[model samples]
Target: MYTRILVPVDHSDTSAAALAEAIRLANEQHAIVRLVHVIDLAQFAWSANEFLDVPQLQSSLRESGEKLLTERVQQVQEGGISVESELLEIWGGQIARTLVDDAVKWKAHLLVMGTHGYGGLTHMLLGSVAEGVMRHTHIPVLLVKATESK
Candidate 1:
């Protein structure tokens, strides 16, 4: 029933797993997939001192994000799914909010992404974006938890 699937990709194994799951779902539902790579420039903006070239850093982030999106789009296309992609840049904004806004704007039927599944200290230190998205939006989110490292 889900016709438009939105997947956030970061080129990590966890994200690849999520993409695989999204591809399988898309194949079964004959749905289209949209891959999104978010570049949070604000996170690095704080380090923009006299020694830091903020503009160059931002450009590099955009280039890497675009590359990731292109690679993911190709993977989805290889799965014989109709795929499109977007590289979203957010400055001094929440990544979860940016993702939810894009999904809502695209009218996506589902949102699939990977979660690192950190707990305790790690979770406290690096807040979970998936958790944030879940709390902020009504969209159906399929979070593929990362596999345990060997």
Candidate 2:
């Protein structure tokens, strides 16, 4: 019986599936759902390198992240579910670390995420956020493998 469910969305199709699952679980348990979107500062840093002021670029990134979160929050709220949203602009580090930190901070009972199937070399080269979260967090995690879109 989860009272607080955390759903991390990156606007990907896989994430959308995860969000839907989270909503279903929340609805059944009458739980509160928290939607979190972490803006990878590392990605923004690359953009900053091309510009003059890094700080200014960071600010712009934060604003964009906030806007994206706000729109998603609105959509979730419109579904008639009790929801809270967060847009975290964390400095480049580890996505898994950031996600687990937020889950603990919010006291989330469950974590629902979508897994973008990555193979050996690909998985090794591009770290899997879900894998990191699962390894570090004690909370229960339900991973939904990405479904093909028709």
- Most lDDT-accurate candidate: 1
Candidate models: Cα lDDT each: 0.91, 0.85
TM-score versus the correct structure, for each prediction = 0.95, 0.88
> Which 10-residue window in model 1 sums to the lowest lDDT?
42-51
Compose the digit string of candidate 2's lDDT tens values, residues 42-109: 66557547666777766777787777678767766776789988887677778899999999999999
Instruction: State candidate 2's TM-score.
Output: 0.88
Model 1, 29-135: lDDT tens per residue? 99999999898887777874678888888899999998888888988999999999999988888989989999999999999999988899999999999999999
Estimate the lDDT of model 1.
Answer: 0.91
List residue ranges in candidate 1 displaced over 4 A.
Answer: none
CA displacement after TM-score superposition, residue 66 of candidate 2 (Å): 1.5
